[model samples]
Target: MSIERTPATPDPNWDRLVADLTAAPAEKPVGPVLQKTADVPVNRPDLLGDMPLTPEWVRTPAGWRTRAEVGKVNSVRAFRRWVRRQSTEHGHGAQVFRGMHRTFLWIQGTEGVQVATARREVQQAQGDYKTAKGHHGRRLIPGKEKYKRRAEMDKAFAGSVTAMSRYKAAQRDARTRRAARGALAAAAVAVPEGAGIYLIGGTGGVIATGSALLAFALIGRRTAGGELYHDHDVKFGDTLKLTDSMLNKIYRDAKVIGADEVVELLTPCTLTADGKAWEVTLDLPSGTPLKKALTAKTGVASALGVKVQQLHQAPGDREGRLQLRVSLHLPFTGKPDPGPLLDLNCINLWRAIPMGVNLRGQEVSTSWVERSGLFGGEPGAGKSAAANDLLLAAALDPTVALYLCDGKAGADLTPFEPIAAMHDTDGEPERLLEILEHIWTVEIPRRRALAKEHGSRKLTAAMAAKDPRVNLAVLLVDEWSSYGAAADRRVREEMERLLRLIVQQGRALGIITLCATQKPDADSVPSGIRDILSIRWAMRCLTPQASDTILGQGYAAAGHNAQDILKSQRGVGIYMDGEGAEPELTRGYYYDDDEVDLILGRAFELRAKAGTLPAGSVPLADQLRAVDDDDARVLAVLLDTFDAHLDGEGEPAEWLPGSVLVDALADAGTALSADSLGRLVVRTDDEKAKRPWLGSRVVGYPRSRVLITVRDRFGMGE
Candidate 1:
């Protein structure tokens, strides 16, 4: 390895090569000099031709190549033009070839200088080629082998293609064979056995013509005969010559249409089923166009008699129910005939009972027969039954005490016999009268006392619980007229006093009076009695006057009349509350004997618990009761008040003139003569005269002196 390698003698050609590479006359370096004159000036060829013929640097004695100082190289316009042309023509797509050469040189040595020199060689080659190529259109053209495989593949494809004429000819032959086979098969089945051949015209020709000709030849018929035997084809607009029976059949097949009903259909259509076609020609009804049939002359559908309504005209396939608009001729009305008012089924007289028995058209549910003193009507005109119904209701309602007085000999009041004590003519009237009097003067006070004792202000509870002597008394009198009509003047006076006090004050005391009579004349049924009755039920009376008397002007307005009254029915009545009441004909509940008995029996049971009535009947004990003289005492006081106040007359000295007591006293005393009284016109009380002395504390005024009347008898406190 110590053998020294001798340096090769420097070839004269090497030096020439180095000089040619470093200072090439063919090209110029790129960069500042080239950039300024990248477009070569046509006028500057001299700068490029006059190239320096020396190497850029030479190796000195120190064995190092020195770089030359070439400062500020001026641009040569012609050279730049030449350089630009060379780069554009050859710079692109030449790097790989240049790199290959450089790499080859580098592999020959391992010196730093060698790598750099190799790189310089690659750059110089690239730039020189770029300069030459850029001046002209220079590009690498692919060699013949570059597309050798593609050309081969294309040749193989061309060799494999068949001739177009031959392929088309084969396809045509196949199609011809298929057509021939189809024709042969169709010919075999063309004439169906026992089936007639029919021809239908096509767009240009007729179908089944061959079959018709074949049939004519087989039958040995002439062309005219075949034509005559052929069936005719029917079409639209053909007049159908149908027989009577056929017409009937067609009519029978027609759908039956309902009156006032309409059917709509899609027109200009044909029905197809199982390859058969049927023609349906439509004939509209003899009216306006269907869409406009229900429309008005104004085209607003006003003929239907409804408001302008809009309906959807959408296709029928949509999923929703269709809304139909119709204007009916009229709404519904009820016709009812008020018929006979009688029934054998008296148990529930309220049901199916005629309107006549239905109390002047008043509904039974709102009859008010149970509420006491709420009606004003005739006495015999269902008042008794209404009163009985009220009593029955009260009997059912245990809160009220039932007190019945049949002053008309207890006949009409007998229906209340189960609960109320049925009074007779024996001694009960006087006793009841006395009871009523006590109710006013004593019972009222006693009730007041009871309320005070209990620290409560209500009398019903205090009296009902504490006092057995008084039930919630509803004293019914059949003949309230009897009180005013009493033959005994004293009894009449006492009865009037009782009636006035009770009718006015009995309501809060729970004493309701239900009195009836055959007559409702002024004296018989006074205004005071009528005022208390807010309810009135008048039945068929003897006159219109009676109806008018019970019910005032509004009676007819409530649909009540005298002719429509139920004359024969037991519990029929026209009810009115007062003189201005609207009379209503309503059925008063007519409870039968058994119903009355049953209701009254329950009433009695309740009464017995309240200790209002005895639980059982007594044995045969005919005991005579003694009458109390207190009745005479009460009657006497009443008679005295009536007589003295109403009939008496007197002078001014003894009492005020026109006072009732004056008349009675005068009637009791002898009639004074005017002559006898002139002497001592009236004797002074101090000088007692022969005349029975007047029982009066009054003093008189002196003659010719006016007497002053004083309201305060003795002064303020007095």
Candidate 2:
């Protein structure tokens, strides 16, 4: 269909000039005009002067129809409005389409001006070259001076030709980038806002349904000069375009903020980009280190309208350049795209473990064959997920032996009991003590012997692959605070000491310690051991103090702020792999339970295929049954806390109240609740347990029976 419209001015030269330099709009008819004629009456008076009339009315070619007849002819404006409405319904989102149209127009205007400017300069150079060539044959004033005059004109002509050639080359280079200009003009990444539909069910239930992934298709260019378009409704692998203005805004806002505080920063350089980051390279003021400007990362972030943790700075020395990587909305959207489980499918143990992602959405992984790492953050900050990345890495490697612990009451690590050589989750001091003892006594000594046998100072994956006897051992503690929370005082301290020893001495033996905790403070994880963990990952923290506690003493002051990460940014964090390097922005891989289980299943198959899976070993249930055998820890606590006098008024009392025993146990660093003591001393349901083990039914352990048990077990008696 065609519409009456004013014709656009013919600009054949300009149109052809920009044809390849910009993305053309989709083919469509001229847009319709929305005049006031669309408004009309649908009904009319029953009669004019008592004339009969029907109920329908509309515009017609013959005349204005009354209430009686309807025909094909209708209001031209109404028909055009309907066409426009349908086009809009089928087009790209209204706001996005408009924004794209404006951006494309702007690009076209700028490119055309650039071409014209080059052409005009070339024309001027061509005129100069012609003048120089024409003057080369000027007549000589005398027979002797003829050759000298001709030589001077020849040199001038040569200079003009060179100038003209340079101008022509520049114009040619611009003409060659027509397709790149088209791609650049079409680049865009803003997602349309989604709508929330509340659905009410029976029993007055309501639910809102929508997916951020469904808001729009992901758009990007995989390589330079590649196609520029959206991947049709991509669910995973989303990326955002980082523009120069967006980067400049971050730096400008930081300066505006710092200027108020008497801090002056150097002018920013041009912003550049690659697949990984939008890089801004500039120098700080003379004599001022880049670290000084980097310290205002939070200031820049607030100006950019993001949480502090979402911004990261990679500072250089005073003599070098400073780089500010602005993530903007990238971290908010770029994360583990929905997909299959990542696991033992990768053969390279060195790079197979997925840590998280860098600012550019690149995969960041760890090679933990002989490294010690500590992961820390507040509760629900994805600390466990980061730890799981390493665990999943080790699990996929058939030559790695696993030792896992979950200090919480829940069973996050229980799923791996089948593969682990030793595992604990209940925080039973005795159980953990034995597990540590086994590693310290049997595991370390064997690894040391294997290391000494080989001439290499450290055991590598190649060595482990060659010799099955010298496999890698991974010790992963899910919760560090649980150790300090143990009921047994000495056992609690011993657990901390053992973690330090493993990280300090286990490097050459191919043993690594990975401790994850919500509390990275000294009370939970001692500073002495924390420094030993070279690879530190600080996820979302609650405050600056907590952020500093996890990264280092001066980490937060240096501008790596993890406390500002939003809750929605679950698996994102700041990472420092070694000392003396600035922390970089990173996102941890987010693998759910089902995804983790998939890797677990594959790991089991790999272990079984390699003949490394546990075979002919005692069942886990059997191990639980043997936990109470001998009961040496109970006997020792009884002997230590025994009262010599009844209520301290008579000769030493052989038996004391259960309450006293509970307090004494806690003081001794052995956490035992009063209710648990009741179950042990006072008999409960006969169907539940055999009977109370203590001889005295009133409250605490009897001194006589305790002496007998101790004498029989440890050969010690009072």
Candidate 3:
């Protein structure tokens, strides 16, 4: 009864009261609050001092970045550097010696053991076969036996004999092969020793002894199951050992990837075939591109603890793939080695020219045939030295006719004057213009005609060998800007036009023009000429603009900036072979003054032997005066006869009779007859103008020199 009375007393405002308890409180009127909005400026100058403006690490002694950089430059690193220098200087020769020794030991030891083993196996097999044969013979019965028994015995005996014969033959064949190998090994050793002694005398004996000892050591180590050296032990310097973890760390530090992302290696990290660099191919994350990696080359180099120049990157086979090369050391830092042409007595222009070595420590050779090249750099940037690589190579080839125009007025190119067909070092723009015109009008046309006569569209080595007129012609213009800077504008314009024509049309005719300039600007090297040149070498420049002028427009943007080259690295340059080829770093081979002299001397001898020396070496008048008395008499009579037959213009008759010259010689009291004159003309013609005064009309007919040539020869010019 009490619970029913309490239930009946429920309030009507209970739902409203519960809703009011759950609902939000009503908004109260409040004054403006002092909230610091992001857009608002702080008002307290004292509290907002430079403390917040500067980074927190600036107030501390050192930041993480600074500390990391400092940690890398310590005594341990210095000691490592010292160790690397020592290994580079002293260990290379030792490694080479050890390698040679090992080779010899393996050849001798393995071959000897193989021969002995083969001989023993052959003897044992033969003995076993003979014993088996003897037993079979003893068991055989000759006359009386059941048919099946006799037949079975014969079949078994025959099968045994066949098997034994096969085994014996196989053993004998093995022994013969092993014996041949041993003989070859002995010959290999003997031949090198004999050649070494014959070539280097007593020094070769010491080398041979050292080689033999090394070989023994190598063989002993191999037999004892020990390796002479490991790849890691022989590493050049503190070369980075590339691994997945290391790569991931490098990528993260370089900012090439986010902290949560990892680069996927498309290929395993490995040493290059040259062993001068470590190569790896990898792919970036899904949204990343290869261009990001290439653009961040310096960052990656910093992460790898190397100079920016030591790291090179190229696009891989597909999108988002990067191929990276980390050089073990800075390339071309040491004194440059001599050129390959120094050892070669002669060279052929048809082959690629041994220009220099590239960044990969591999030799770089470029073909100049059907191509023109432009080399440019600032003064002392090895512009002339790079030109000399091609010039000296051309000089060594007797078949290449060299025409040099040295505008620098220096002796750098003077050594080649003796071998040059046309050499001008006076920096005279008029002379250069004349030379270019001659090349354009005379040389190009002559080469075209000769090529046509030989049924060839282009000049070839074979054609050059057969005909001297069809040889390759190379025109080198050092300091090409000197011509453009000439006082006369007309001369400069003509030169540029002729150069453009020569570069565009003369390549197929076996004419190559190599132009070099210290100032590689639009004014110095006109775009019309520079654009047609396929091969361009840009050495150290003052700006990327200058590099673009030499290599082509937009090349500097493509990461081939010659200005990036160190001033200390003189001959190093960016080489662009063609429009499609990527520019690469190359160090031109050094050619000092002494080396140039030697090369010139050798070239002189080669040209002299080939009879390709320039005619300017001897004066024509002097040559004419040096003729024998009989030749002089015949020449005098021929000159007189030509004078009598000359037209009013003083031109010699197109066709003159041998009899007429002979009659004149007789009148001059010469004993030479008409037949003798004909024979003399034929004989002198075969000598390729041994006597410059002598001229011929038909094959058998003798003709006289023109009036001007006669006057010039006799020094009778006005």
Candidate 4:
């Protein structure tokens, strides 16, 4: 267990502290210092001048005052002591050495201060050990054996020194041998077969330590006779990017020329000749600027567009063939253009905005989830229908598999069951949660495996082509806040983890999620999930905080409301694509329930014929399958019951107790317990007098004035 520290006790000497804190000390005039020794003779003039000394005093009408006055001298001295302790403990010489340059000390018998500058008395290095101590004297030296023992000790150290030198020499010889071996290995590399090696003679010649003179060396010559360019081990179809210095020797020496003043080029070359005698004439348009001309002639001639040679001749040759070698000429001093070949294909956020999505070009649609996106808004903001339309567009693609979990039961997403794979009221919140996690867990590992197999740093073309798993899976979640609210803590944590990872890596794996929620608060949308979702699709929100939470700060400040958004109609969305994807108001694509049904009917037909296709690739039968008869019946029941309740068709019903109540609730599928029913009955009666009811009331004995029926069975009571 760790002990906690608390504040220190109050001062014990209260009377002294009070007196000293309040009272002022007597002020005295500054005085001069009487020098103990002004001139001490020393061999080093530099050392003597560096020592601290007293200065002359000046006399004034106020009295004599010393020119030097110190302030905060005690504090400075304490700080210096602390710093020295730290340096000694830490073993950093500079930490202590830097402090010695300046220090302060209080003058004795005066309330004044003195500043002193210090210089090191001894040399830091061993070579100057003797010279350094001359100023301090021999007493300062640490070890002394006297005269007799010194000779033997010195000889022993000398012997050790000799042994060290031999050891160092052996190390050097070993390094030299290693270097020679490297040179021989390099020399063994063979030139490509048939590529002639020509010796372009150098001015100087040398032999081994004891070798006789050889024949006259081969000097500079044209490729026709004995002279040839040595073909080094250049592999086939390799582009040689040459430095300017090499170009001067290669092309300038050969006097080869070409056209095009500005040559921004890259290319490869093929060797026509075998052996070192590789030579060819690259004819050029005359009077072209040598730099521009050479780029056009040699660069264009070589398989690699880069120009490797200037003149085709070897060095020292008076005349030679104009052969095109493969090489690149770097721009002298300019920024390299990183075009499509090198950089990520980032889109401009400005141009991609949907036509009416951003009224002021402020927002753009995100290409995040293929075409569809998350919709953030308040209740009755047309968020549900708007989301439906976007998903409908995505459903057009056969390769895209859409899974929508409508936590509003089936209310929000049920209309799209005809076109999209949907989980409705039939799905338990727990099962929906499980399905989401399973999709991500399986997907994440598969993506990782694909990235590893292709040796790709990310989802590159190479990996995507090889891995069938990297396909689009559009996951649509309506009212995610409700999903989280209904889920247990463990389930919520799992959802958070899955969403965080999916939002981060989903873009590369072609998996996209369109998560919609009425609540867009810090607590509702986690930080990790929000960071990667720079793309936003916002609807009208109740408050400024909610709006800003969805579309950045100041969105609600603009006064958009449900009336304004609904006026825009369904299938209309603001597009925010690319980098600057601020929320753009867009007219989203729309499809009615009939159109969606027809399309999915076709898809279902394909699915039935094809059996189970991959996640993204839906079979035609699966896409176009008719809604099952059982599902239709359940949906009809919910609609009819809710409508009847809303229309006030269900009349006032009498209250029944205990067994009677349980049986009634069971038939209605309300599933309340007898105790729960009793509590609700009591509370309902108590509050009935306070708030008038719009629906039927049942007046009975003991439990009098209890509301036996819902406001309206189909919700028309109000």
Q: Model 4's lDDT to the true fold?
A: 0.41
Which stretches of candidate 1 lie above 4 Å from their native place? 1-381, 415-418, 421-432, 451-471, 552-564, 577-582, 614-718
Model 2 Cα lDDT, one tens digit per residue, 1-718: 1211232666565543344224332232122111111222222312222322221122322224321122122234335544564454232344344444554565454555666666666676667656655655566467566666567667666665666676566656655565555565433221211112222332222111122222221221121244343322211112123334444444556673233233233323211122222334455444555555667776776665555544556754555356556543346454466422362373545444667777755566666666788888878888877877777777778778888877765567867777777888776666767777778888888888887788777777777668767777888776667756764778778877777787788866878888888888887778888888878889888898888887888877777778767788787778876565567778777778988888887887677556566643332222222335435555456556674245456655666666667777787677878776554444335422332335644444555655565455544433
lDDT of 4 by residue, 1-718 (tens): 1211322565565545344424442132122122111131111111112221212111221112111111133245445644654444222233233222211111111111111101111112222433333423445444553443455445545555555555556556555655665454333322211122223222111221011111101111122243333323222223132332233333333344322222221111221111111222333234433344333343333423232221121111112223333312221112212211112112221113222232221223334432334567776555665565445444444445567787667555665454454444443668676666766777667766776777764554344356544445677777666677788888888878877777667766666677677776755566567545655656655555665666665433332222234422343333344344433344433344665566455544443333323333442222223234332222232223333333245632322224444554466555666575555444444433322234644422122223122121211112
Native-to-model Cα distance after best TM-score fit, residue 187 in candidate 2, in Å: 45
Tens-digit lDDT track for model 1 on 66-92?
111111111243244445533531321
Higher-scoring candidate on TM-score, 2 or 3: 3
lDDT accuracy of residue 70 in candidate 1:
11
Tens-digit lDDT string for candidate 3 (1-718): 0112123568786555444434443242121111111222211111123332122232233334443443454345546755664464233454455555665465445444544655565566556655555544555544444454555556655655665565566566656766676677666567667777888987986687667555544444332234343333322234445556678778888898999999887555644433456667788998987667776776788788787777777776688888777876677788998789889999988889899998766689988888899999988899888998999999899888888898777787778877788888988888888888999999999998888999988888788778867778899887777766763888888888888898888999999888899886777778778788889999999998998888877767656778878888899999887667777889999988889899988988777656576866633333343454456556656665665787668876544655566677778788787566655555344522222224643332434333344445444322
Give the Cα-based TM-score of candidate 3 against the true structure.
Answer: 0.55
lDDT of each: 0.40, 0.59, 0.70, 0.41
Q: Give the lDDT of residue 694 in candidate 3.
A: 47
- Give the 10-residue window scoring lowest on summed lDDT in candidate 2: 29-38
Model 1 residue 569 CA deviation (Å) reads 4.5
